[model samples]
Target: MTAIRLFGLAALLSLSSMASATSFVGTTDMIGRALISTTDGISDLSSSLKDDKIVLAARDDAASFVASQGEIRGARLHAALQHIRTQAPQLNASDLQLAEAILAL
Candidate 1:
């Protein structure tokens, strides 16, 4: 009986964690889509993110932006985005998408 209870607890714990992770991913996707829909598609996101260091520099603000559902725009994020653009400027995507991309980075 105890073994059975433990098994059930383990399953429940695993399921809860999976659900939490799924929600996290959903939040990111939702934010990205909303930003894309709201913005005019004139700007382009990063051409390609080869340097992890650049992305890492703005990871905190990116996370905050995602957590806030984009309510929180960080100064660091703008700085990083400009840096990214200067490094690679040929693609096509909106600033919002680029912000989302920076979060993904």
Candidate 2:
């Protein structure tokens, strides 16, 4: 009975260690992918916001008026505006101006 008890304890420890070792490898891979995805998402969001700022700033009153009229005609532009609303702040300024620009566009 004593020998059986000792064998059981050893088996439990061995299984526990093996399970831990396998999970550590899997956890490392998952963490690595998450970090890469976060970095890429941030970069893409920043670039897009910068482009929107440039387009808005570069345009004159006439172009802006045209853009304002564009709301109905341009579904893609509207979707881009939505992306800006959702993603711009975490990358840069959480500003009233940014919100207004999205609405105006």
Candidate 3:
């Protein structure tokens, strides 16, 4: 009985850890998608990207920002991208694309 309990506890802990990891990855992906949508100038790029779920997630992230902070344009967009870069330097490629898009705007 004690062994079974220990095994169950271990399983629960493992499942919890997996959930946490998944949440982190989802958040990171959301940030990356938001950057892509911002650069591409499309709120719903899922049709273009051929991945409805992922693109929709990206749109949601971008929309969240717009809802909270008004429209993102000009210096505000640049500042937001900079802050995202600082927070996730691993997303450098997306940052470059965003920078190009900002220049075009």
Candidate 4:
């Protein structure tokens, strides 16, 4: 009986952790979509990102990446994106897809 109880508890804990992880992923997707949609000619991504909590979190993550590597521009930004893709594949995949929707200008 104790073994069965322990098994059930372990299953519940695993499921809860999975749920929380997906919640953050969903937030990432939302933030990415917002960024893609809001960015336009002569406008900055930071303006759109500032209003949302999830985007703020993502920005902080990106800032940390930039701080460690020194300066985020051109190739550096690309490197950061690639790092994010490897570190959090699900979230970065969504971000990349949304980024593709926006024009560079």
Which candidate number would show the highest TM-score if scored against the true structure? Answer: 1
Residue lDDT tens for model 4, 25-94: 9999999977665444113443433353443334444554445553433443455455444544434234
Q: Give per-residue CA lDDT, model 3, range 38-71, as digits (tens).
A: 6445222212333333233344345444455534
Off by over 4 Å in 4: 41-105
Alpha-carbon lDDT, every model: 0.69, 0.54, 0.51, 0.49
Runs in model 3 lying further than 4 Å from the true structure: 42-105
Q: How far is 84's C-alpha from truth in model 3 (Å)?
A: 22
Determine which window of 10 residues in candidate 3 has minimal summed lDDT: 42-51
Model 1: ten consecutive residues of lowest lDDT: 38-47
In TM-score terms, candidate 1 sits at: 0.44
Off by over 4 Å in 2: 1-4, 54-81, 85-105
Ordered from best to worst lDDT, the candidate numbers read 1, 2, 3, 4
TM-scores, in order shown? 0.44, 0.39, 0.39, 0.38
Candidate 3 local accuracy as lDDT?
A: 0.51
Largest lDDT belongs to which candidate? Answer: 1
Candidate 3, 30: how far from true, in Å?
1.1
